[model samples]
Target: MKKLIPIFILCVLSCQSIDTPEEPETVLEEELMIDILTDIAFIRAAKTSSRKVFDEKGINPESYILRKYGVDSIVFAENNAWYGGQLERYKEMFTVVKSNIEVSKIKFEKLKKEEDSIKKVQDSIKKATGDKKDDKKDKKNKKNKKEELEIDDAKNRAIEEEMEKARVKRFNNLSGKE
Candidate 1:
């Protein structure tokens, strides 16, 4: 019985050791939270700047602000953080800013394409409808004008649809739904 008791105690200790799981290495949640907060703050600042430029100056604010501050200067300042924690925070903010610029560039490209298409349509319509009119020429001109008007109307509808799609896409991307 004494030998059996020693064997049972040994088995129990072995089972306990075998079944115990190792704890995962600690991650600093606070640091992660702070980085996320910094990124959010940077995005908010960019949105505010964009609104200010659009509302007050009738222009996109990003290039204006970048020019005002000097991109190189801002980059240099961000790179030279005095403390390690601050360096991480600055890096996070920089990433956010870069992402914002990338999204803005995509939107600008879409707008430019739409603008070019509208201009081309407008020029064609002008040329078609601006011809000199007299008798036979006047009848032909009226028919051409009607066709031009229909084309213009179609172009306007297309532009409006594209603009709406772009607006929805932008909103979705900004809201993190995309």
Candidate 2:
């Protein structure tokens, strides 16, 4: 009888359910979550690469990222906990995030290479056209160069604004908001 009682008690204790965390009311979609994780990975890398620069800029990387995705810390935490409870799903999400970071790294490196090449070409062209002309011609060339720079700056700003708007729109869509 004592052995049966102890066995019954053990079975009862083992059968009791473990409390699971409640899912957030507004759980971020898996895709959005992956993107957020990827951005966090990038920021983590950047911070490690230059902690001094981040401190000087006074940028809270995590807050900036959460704001970008329109997610609150509390909700993010709840969703993260929910996702983490599913080991396989969380593992898959991490794999996607890592792949995304790797892809971004490759793209950034390619862009940097292209920019360096462009700068080298520009410098060579500038040297070849060194200020060997008359004073009046040189002044005119300088004025033309200044105007071109201004025009380029305006175009660049416009393009940046458009890209930002597009990014926001995509985020909004992913979040199921207007």
Candidate 3:
């Protein structure tokens, strides 16, 4: 009976401790420190990358760079000395830049292939139609329009999926309690 009484009192005290709220001032101070540390790290990264122009730009460059890179802003900020904003922007920019590069490469390849196809078509029209100018022009125009539409469709699909993934990740991160 005595042991039970002591155990009950301990449990009550433990429960009381668990219900206590964290001091607001302490949390604020910690958050401020984290912000400062993140800013410092961002500065360092910018300096290293010779992107120090970002500092002068008055925008959080690190978040921009991190976002462009397609990295999580929070993770990048937490790991680096930069704030969340710059890292987030950085990640986004990185993704856009990379995608643009890839798109350009694809466009270049398609253009090259299109040029070859046009040449072949021109030669065939001349040989088969005995130089029917209007027929060649119509066929070339149709081919160009079709290729443009296909490229536009492909680019739209890629961009939509990329944006969707980013949106989902953002939603998940925000919904988390931690």
Candidate 4:
């Protein structure tokens, strides 16, 4: 009976190993996975900031991302699972994603600043030229400017929130998850 018990345990362990799913046939490239994850992080931040807007627009972020990558949810799930099983590799991939987000934030801010400066210069020139635009045109311009500013503000907030999350994740991941 004692020997049968040991054999049963061995059989159970072997069966569990056998039940392990096979490596997915279509594995997403590491770079592509990183990109998808980065986009996901961005989407998360956007959703956090404007969940109502997304709901109103019927914007299915995860589906859109999967479609964008030409991969179905099943494929993404398989690839994600594979990566999740590899602690070190997944850590490295996330680190890359975090860095990409930082770079994006810096570039976005720089471009935004440049664009604002250019707009200011153009406005000054327009005023200096004594352009007597119609009230309708002026009103339209103001409306457009207001809309643009609002969009920019929303984006800035999302990015800032994502940056904070990234910082926290970076700290936690570095704390040794093993």
Best candidate, lDDT? 4
Model 3 superposed RMSD (Cα): 36.4
- lDDT tens readout by residue for model 4, 1-178: 9999999999999987854345799988999999999999999998999999999999989899889989889999999988987879999999999999999999999999999999999999888664556566888899999999999999999999999999888888999652
TM-score of 3: 0.25
TM-scores for every candidate against the unseen true structure = 0.31, 0.61, 0.25, 0.61
Candidate 3 lDDT over 1-178, as tens digits, reads: 9899999999999987753222232122333334434544545655768655655766766556555555565554443333223567446544554565567679989999999999999988878886566788989999999999999999999999999988888888899833
| Residue-by-residue lDDT tens digits, candidate 2, 64-92 | 99999999988888898999988899999
Clashes of each: 0, 0, 30, 0
lDDT against the true structure, per candidate, is: 0.62, 0.89, 0.63, 0.90
Candidate 3 residue-wise lDDT at 22? 28
Residue 96 lDDT in candidate 3: 54
In model 4, what lDDT does residue 116 have?
100
Note each model's CA RMSD in angstroms. Answer: 31.7, 31.4, 36.4, 33.7
Ranking by lDDT: 4, 2, 3, 1
Cα lDDT for residue 7, model 1?
98
Root-mean-square deviation of Cα positions for candidate 2 versus the true structure, in angstroms: 31.4
Tell me the spans in candidate 2 whose CA falls farther than 4 Å from its real position: 1-19, 131-178
Q: Which residue pairs show backbone clashes in model 1?
A: none
Q: Which runs of model 4 end up more than 4 angstroms from their true locations?
A: 1-22, 131-178
Clashes of 3: 30
Model 2 TM-score, 2 decimals: 0.61
TM-score of 4: 0.61
